[model samples]
Target: MLEFDIWELYRMMLRSRLFENAVMKLWEEGKITGEMHLGTGEEAIVAGVVSQLIDGDAIAVTHRGTPQFIMRGIDPVLLLLEFFGHPKGLCKGQGGHMHLFSKEHLIAASGIVGSSGPAATGFALALSYKKQNNIAVAFFGEGAINQGMMLESMNLASVWNLPVLFVCCDNNWAVTTTTNKSIGGTLIDRAKGFGIEGCSVNGTDVEAVWELANEALSKIRNNGGPQFIHATCTHLEGHLLGDLLLRHNRDPVLMAETADSLKQYAGESLNEVLMLLRKIGGQTKKKGDPIVFIKKKLKDDADRLKLIEEEVTKQIDQVVNNALEISKGGMKND
Candidate 1:
């Protein structure tokens, strides 16, 4: 059995959450621009898998990759600076949040759907050439599984017996559309079609995901070929920071305003919008928060947990302030 420190896992999740929360605040304050896609609900999954990664193990993440990058040990200051559009960011502020790349950490992210598959597959191929026993991880949403490139990557990994773990953070929504509405069948079944064996778990349960990921990584390290993990989670902030469908559902005034506009122009799509809102509302109600779930388990050690939270919050606050300070003067290109 794989033993893990639940407190540490909780800390990782908490740190990622707090960092993103700070980013969200920056975006809300107009300090950051563009649509911000956060990995708020997939914290457990990212922390669980990343905790087991060793040096040389590469990771390719989907659009909501802040948590993954942070867990993989990327500097939060540079990441924040990147979001702040600083020249000394991970990609010199060119990649933004979605297109972050940390070559030193072997981590890459993209906003395009299904891109992680190819990216990770390429990483796995490189590792295979080195025969380093290192592995590559592809973190993406369930919706990406339907893409042809993703399926091809799975097939190639299985065929080559590459050390890659395809982690599907299934939040049941592809943008505003639910999984069932868009996806044809189960995500596991799709992986199976590529001859990749896998399992599913609750993403909100940090310990559960950690245990499962540990087993999967062990198998890959043992030359058991590629594996897949389908973890169901919730996107607490919807697809984007200020997502209209989710906002409309939560705010009556916004709903009224959206409904009126839709009724005036796109009356036929109004019911469809409301139906999606209902689904989103239902998803939020049913899903559990990863942070809350783990915190409940550690409530007996409230003092320690409180200390960790405070420390992490302080660290993130310092990172933000430092990044902001640097952005004021700007860092020259190397």
Candidate 2:
């Protein structure tokens, strides 16, 4: 069982990696149109932070939100289809890499810069008004710190004591502009200016992010107001899809450095998880044909996908039924 959890974490990382590669390939092949931001190295932040969220919690994400959407239970196939602009996509082929909406999960991912902050604050405000203990998370980049809307949202969240967590994904660079050149002050300081608690975490370390976010979520659940966390992660790839080739900008050195860092962190975590799994007698299947391993994993994913689809359908049906019942009643004079 412990091995399962570790493997699951690794699997989620692999899925995000694969999904990113697929999207980049599509962009190169001219299949994916418009601007695309690929989150190749920042998978841990999304996976780790999202693991702390409950079923009914809401999430607001920035342009590089594919991993968050997947972590929130979006199917890889559906995500791929969405990238391909298929009719059966998450946004019905309307939203591409930057925009992803999953009503069932209460997620509203945006392409606009710093847009998620206010949306997250709004969700938190609604939850507070309804007396719900649900927490809302806003995932934005360091570049978003310069946007006025982010500050405004932070002020609103602090003033209202909303259950919102602002996650600043400090990937060092915001697009082509470096954070040092763009951001005037420290990210944590910005949170402090709003009278919110803040922490700086190693975004490459999934375990660290998970621990910190878990603690913050617990505080929010207990009505602790707003918190901000700066995840100092690395950007292993270009800002947008195909920009690497288009701009003739190569960062092989940075890519290798970031990969080494993540690998070191993952290795330590994997070893711990493996030890726990060994105590439970859970081990990976014996070496076999590569094709067989691929087939087995694919089959398992297919089954899980079916289950997720069924659950989403059921939720949609419930919403429809509720709406229909409300419509059936005659309009009462206010």
Candidate 3:
């Protein structure tokens, strides 16, 4: 039996989506600088995995890590302040969103593609040395599997019997190129070659991810050594916020500009680009929206759902407002 609270998972997913939406607004208004990578699409995978984590457990995530950090109980206000480069931010205005580090939470993230594997493995090594019954998790994209460091980390984790769960959030696209075109063979087979047990799951379903992650964590806790989870998710917002391809699909002017650029330099036709964009856009449909999927399942308790959404919205609004005030020097910092 799947023993978990659907409402709690729904609330977590909703809060992550709303929080990222607020961050998107900030980036749009030019308040938050730099290329922001919103985890707008991978909410289910993040919530499912992070919610199952206990204290003393560690995590290392990829560049699109806001969802995981927030779900892991980091203060959203501090995260926003960091994005704004405020001195009171998480890394004291130094790390921004990509290079977030929270020793208190035992979580660290890097913009580097495959660095999470090594970081999480190191955390697992430390846990082993200290004789703690906790584990470490590394979250990365399918593209990172090709990186030598990532493969080596997996091998090392297996060799030394480290309690680390390597999660491959395969979105089928590595930035712009299709991941299947680059990655050879199945990821599960790759893990098996390294003596690690694993499973694959549809990351869009929160309950599915939750159940599988719970089972994997249970095994790791029982000294099952290193485990792997190849969860396939959709990167609905392309690679980053204000993605050029998605922008072209939305704005006619950008579309024309892209067409002209392609014709002038690459000699590619606009028809080809449109066809590709259409295919990508089709994937971001009703079936892929994890938030709506879970919300539908919880429809029996509509009143409770409404209250949860309202609470999350109000909380996120206050967080954004306070973070903005602090960023604008209108409020005191902690």
Off by over 4 Å in 1: 1-3, 261-268, 331-334
Candidate 3 per-residue lDDT over residues 150-220, each given as its tens digit:
99999999999999999999888888778757988999999999999999999989899998999999999
User: What would the TM-scores of all predictions be?
Assistant: 0.95, 0.72, 0.94
Model 2's lDDT to the true fold? 0.71
Q: Identify the runs in model 3 with alpha carbons over 4 angstroms from their true place.
A: 1-3, 260-272, 330-334
Q: For residues 80-153, could you state the per-residue lDDT of candidate 1 as single tens digits?
A: 98987778888998999989998899999999999999999999999999889899999999889889999999
Which model is ahead, 2 or 3, in terms of lDDT? 3
Question: How many pairs of residues collide in model 2?
Answer: 0
What is candidate 3's TM-score against the reference? 0.94
Candidate closest to the true structure, highest TM-score: 1
